[model samples]
Target: MLERRGVMVSGAAAVCFYEVCPTVDQYCQLRLIAGLSEKAKEAAEMALPKTVFAVSGYHCCDLVAMGRIVGDGACHLQLCDIAVHPRLQRQGLGREVVLRLTAWLDKNLPPSAEVSLIAKGASNLLYAQYGFVPTAPAAISMCRRC
Candidate 1:
């Protein structure tokens, strides 16, 4: 695993045990706590089931961070909904979440599988650390929201 800040995680992130996927309620709540906007509960319900792989970090029996890999696992995949609770920020939990999802992709997906994520602001730096780079000048990222 890639170390965070040249140091192995030894705090909440290190202690948290990750599940392959969290319950829908857990997924939504984690996102909300991270200051992400809330969506209809039904939307969350539908989305959670579609994830190809997900990782939820738990510390002291409470869910503290989360991320999900969605899209076609074989040919293309997108990482989304990565968040760590405000109280849990800076504990490496966010990195741990990404690490888990990427590790799963590396092990399970074929080499031909293409992975991408739309990272905003400073989060780009974090994603870059995991080998995600800008496709700028080649391909641009575009999105449509409902």
Candidate 2:
């Protein structure tokens, strides 16, 4: 897992994470983040051509199994779209990606840099291992359906 948010690269066998969007339209179609279609599109368009870091070990040469970091460098970084194909799950690829990204954060971000992520399901355990404690003391997280 290369940790530079938006830094793209390809290759690996079992570690490929999908390259989601080349445009906002594609991102909305894929992620379907509720009211986020328009906003996500704008962001994706701005961030496209940006190298979203990924990992892979599938031996195929695509970054099809990996995770990504999205945000402005330095201040705010959000870990997003972390996926390892269903076939690749339980093989520690996800953990590897998180660890790699954490290591990159440690090396690059300033001590005050704020790194964040929204985990899906039980995956919070993995993020916890990387020091992503819940934001409880600050505020409870919530999502509303439209």
Candidate 3:
């Protein structure tokens, strides 16, 4: 069993999962969550190359879910691009995905490793419940494409 944020998860398994396509459908769902344009071709081009996606196929048995963790293995990790289909929302699947990913990180990343993520809307509260704190007072965040 895995526990986080007053939730318990079991009976699910995640392998050494990786996906290159991750489906345009799934991509569009995640883009909606992030408040990005679901019709933006540039967003699709930008997201496809950077995502390392995982999905669940146990209960509802579909590729209607996804998440990603991108970073150097030793010191930094960023959890991003998490999305469950609209029909599956509020069914505890998102928490399950985050739990599995953090479990993977705990086992694989170094002891002092720091994981970062850009949470969408109230999702920041979800991540905070998993021990993610604001990177404030010490440093601010910035991004650029190059």
Candidate 4:
């Protein structure tokens, strides 16, 4: 079952509706407007359904922010696709998305499960507030395009 809530974005004076998942079209458009990597429709359709948990903020039906977790349900989980529209950045919607995702994780994850995300740019700072730490020296994040 998908959860829904409404919040007023500071400074925008608009009520943003938050829901558990975004439609494939909304997901792709949000990624593009938020300066995240582009995702093909087929790829997004394949990916969104696999989310372990997801949160999307929409203002009057337009996707403004989103975050999602994807991984095996028990052992390893990765937070990915965090994005906020440029106009909505710093308005607390991104934080709200993360907060919702993490809250879900807290309730669902087993004690031994590992949660991880590849933070980009200054996003690590925001994520750090939620108990994420830099895994440098002892561990490094490595990725390559398929």
Candidate 5:
């Protein structure tokens, strides 16, 4: 089990326990329920152990939110799999997870490290508050399913 790092109380008075990294099963289930793209268990197994930093939030014993940073420790880092359960959306759980992840990055990353994340839909709005901006003319994000 991931150890508890902190506790949060949502606006609706829901108490949530936060921890560093979730188990593979919790990671898969939370992403599905939170509407992120599905990732295969094998992929998750290969990936989770490579995470540089991660945060998972649970309401009681149920996982409700998560975020992770992946990359080589020095040069490249990307924020991925940020999610919050629909029932708990707008309660700041997502923001809290991002906040914790960024705080960790601030302390741990080298000065030259480039951190990035692909924001989908209006999620760029949420990420914007934390200093992310459109790469635009200089660069545009593009991807294809594997």
Candidate 6:
């Protein structure tokens, strides 16, 4: 057991990081809690395996958070699909997930690697604490529908 901000965390309720993707059901549930759109199970199944790397946080066997690293391993990398269960937020579980993923990147990624993550408005601060900076006009993020 561990203590954070006066709260007792346990193997069952404290955050534990795992180097595995959550199940499709777990993914959908966590995303919904984190306010992301639900992905089709078929698409998720096809894509989850293609993830270059993934991390999940569990508390007492309950999957509470997840994140993924995608794109070419050497030159291009993006952090996507980060989510922390709504009921479990504000307890640093999200930070733990990101930290574990970034720590892995630090050791495994080549020197030429470029990493980026698209953040929601409120989450920019959380990410900024981990060295992420806004690129602004220098490189605007763009997206288009297929």
Q: How many collisions per candidate?
A: 0, 22, 0, 0, 0, 1
Quickly count the clashes in candidate 1.
0
Give the top-scoring candidate (lDDT).
5
TM-score of each: 0.86, 0.63, 0.65, 0.93, 0.92, 0.87
Q: Which lDDT values do the candidates have, in the order given? A: 0.78, 0.58, 0.60, 0.84, 0.86, 0.80
Name the runs in model 2 displaced over 4 angstroms. 1-46, 51-58, 62-64, 142-146
**Deviation of model 2 at 84, angstroms:** 0.4
lDDT of 2 by residue, 47-96 (tens): 65564443333325433345567677788888876655454456666677
**Number of clashes in model 4?**
0
Query: How should the candidates be ordered by TM-score, best one leading?
Result: 4, 5, 6, 1, 3, 2
Of candidates 2 and 1, the better by TM-score: 1
Candidate 2 TM-score over all chains jointly:
0.63
lDDT tens string, model 3, 1-146? 21112222323432222333455655665557645445466666676666443433222323444577777656777887677656556666677677767777777777898888876678887787778888878977788755
Q: What is the lDDT of residue 143 in candidate 4?
A: 94
Worst 10 residues of 3 by lDDT: 1-10
The residue-level lDDT of candidate 3 at 23 comes to 59
Prediction 2 global C-alpha lDDT: 0.58
Error (Å) of candidate 3 at residue 103 is 0.6
Best-to-worst lDDT order: 5, 4, 6, 1, 3, 2
> Candidate 5: minimum summed lDDT over ten consecutive residues — where?
11-20
**lDDT of model number 6:** 0.80
Expressed as tens digits, the lDDT of each residue in 99-142 for candidate 1 is 87888888999988999998887999899989899999999999
Q: What is the C-alpha RMSD of each candidate to the true structure, in Å?
A: 4.8, 6.5, 6.6, 1.6, 1.6, 4.7
Clashes of 6: 1
> Cα RMSD (Å) between model 4 and the true structure?
1.6
